[model samples]
Target: MPPTLKKSDFHYDLPPELIAQAPLPERSASRLLVVPPAPAAFDDRGVRDLPALLQPGDLLVFNDTRVIPARLFGRKATGGRVEILIERLLGSHEAKAQLGVSKSPRPGTRVVLDAGGEFEVLGREGEFYLLRLLGEEPLEKLLLRAGRLPLPPYIQREAGADDAERYQTVYAKQVGAVAAPTAGLHFDEALLDALRARGVEFGHITLHVGAGTFQPVRAETVEEHRMHSEWLNVGAELVEQVRRTRARGGRVVAVGTTVVRALESAVRDGELQPFAGETRIFIFPGYRIRSIDALITNFHLPESTLLMLVSAFAGRERILAAYRHAVAQRYRFFSYGDAMLLFPGRES
Candidate 1:
């Protein structure tokens, strides 16, 4: 019989103090933990060593989805404070968002923004509220003016001035994601230029990371957890890049789990195709990774789907051991923390 997989199998002990509350002053200054397929083997390096670690023709896939200022603070008609976090922008005036308040507002209730505007609660999409901004200005414009950068909850502080740029990746172009792809946060313009000089080809994909990424796994078994849907775009150009890279015997190194999901989602019927749609692909151990040969990603929460993904790529035991090493050695954890470079197992 196959080994039973439970959520507890992935749990690890993490101290609250280890969660990184702020980003390093230099984007590329974070440490890199290289975890190869060989069990119990890892090398402590720096993010600046990336170009050296990769082969010349390897394709580095990056997520270019820009993080919008998604967190909005406002008040209800009854003077109750409400925080609205955009889940997905519906149009220029409409968005689906998760609302936080003492009491849930009924339909048609107006929410007054601290930035001198209001949005009407139209209805609901599961737990999210369907909201329509009551203004002539576009939704993007309002968010820029009124919305705050939605840092991860573990950051333990309000968004500060530095967060405007520090929280975003240098290569971000497509403005849609609510959360920054944390792994890409380590790459500065200099690092990208260095990678290019080393002949590491680049490919772009867009996966607007949703706020639900931070949600805890409540299910008892790994397979029982449902993934949150996020928008992903894998253009024909990127598809061609992947094909060319493969034809030349080069590797496909994904920058983050978002890129992995986007690329893998594009592959259907045993081939990769251009795709632009929503995906809720939940990756865990016992899963096969067809699109990526390696990954660069930040440390993830224990029992989190992201951790499970890396476990899927490199054996679960090896990954958990690396995490323990990271913790013992005082390596930072979470969004604003250090990163890990993982090579795929032979069977993955």
Candidate 2:
């Protein structure tokens, strides 16, 4: 740990009315704010403008982790209502989860799912519940059959049929994340094809975004707030792609924070390498970012780690100014909202 930054330093006032409750009918139609290398400067654009903004040889890294239906409503043996959000799968028949109940269920308590399956608490993993599926099916199968898409809480609406597709990336392949890599949500097959036709290269990484993404930073000092560990896999192919791109003087553009984290985590020991494990890497001011040349991302929550990350990438004052500008322009905010294409900052 290093000297801590005050969490309050990242705070900003956002109008609740700007919080996006639903996604636009078209993913690529979301407004794109192009953040130039000078952090304070902004260019109004659309996501569809991305191909024109990048060089032909640039490599775009995308997180391909799929969002699983991780939210389940159930009843305990005593008939009390319970909500379970899977945090991590431990085995085909077991998982770690956050259980919401009137009272935390004791180990051995059985919860009957509304979709007609059951699970029993095995024990606790800190604040999370370790549970075993009470049926023969694999945990993934049971969840897909019985669970609902766990939308971010700020959305203020129940998950609906549309979320099953809209909340996921069109290119999602690996199945595990509870939340979407929101920046990836703005790219459809057509947009991807357009980029490909322009000679932009693509690479994929997997990072199972946990439910803890929505957890507020509780520590007053930013460095004291530990990031929840999320499983990530940075493949060898992507490592090779990065080397090839930089060798050709092409930029390596990360699609979301997860891609940034995965790439950066792979190079923590000073050289890029394939990695498959958990990362609790927390990026903030004064941290050196070694992986990305540019980033395509969504507007993040005020006082969030994601915001801190962008601030670290582009200097705190400049990021906050862009945020204020976005607010003034009434840009939709948060997951399922608008996007931003950021160039390398002088501060990065």
Flag regions of model 2 displaced more than 4 Å.
Answer: 1-4
Error of model 1, residue 74, in angstroms: 1.5
lDDT of 1 by residue, 1-348 (tens): 447689888989999999999999899999999998874468999999999999999999999999999999989988999999998899899999999999989999999998888899999878899999997988999999888999998889999999999999998999898899999999998999999999999999999999989988899888889889999999999999999999999999999999999988999997999999999999888888889999999999998999898898987888888999999988999999999999886443
> lDDT (CA) for every model shown?
0.92, 0.90
lDDT of 2 at 328: 96
Worst 10 residues of 2 by lDDT: 339-348
TM-score of 2: 0.97
Model 2 lDDT tens row, 35-93:
88672559888999998998899999999999999999989989999999999888798
The backbone clash count of each candidate, in order, is 0, 0
Candidate 1 least-lDDT 10 residues: 339-348
- Model 1 regions more than 4 Å off: 346-348
Predicted model with the maximum lDDT: 1
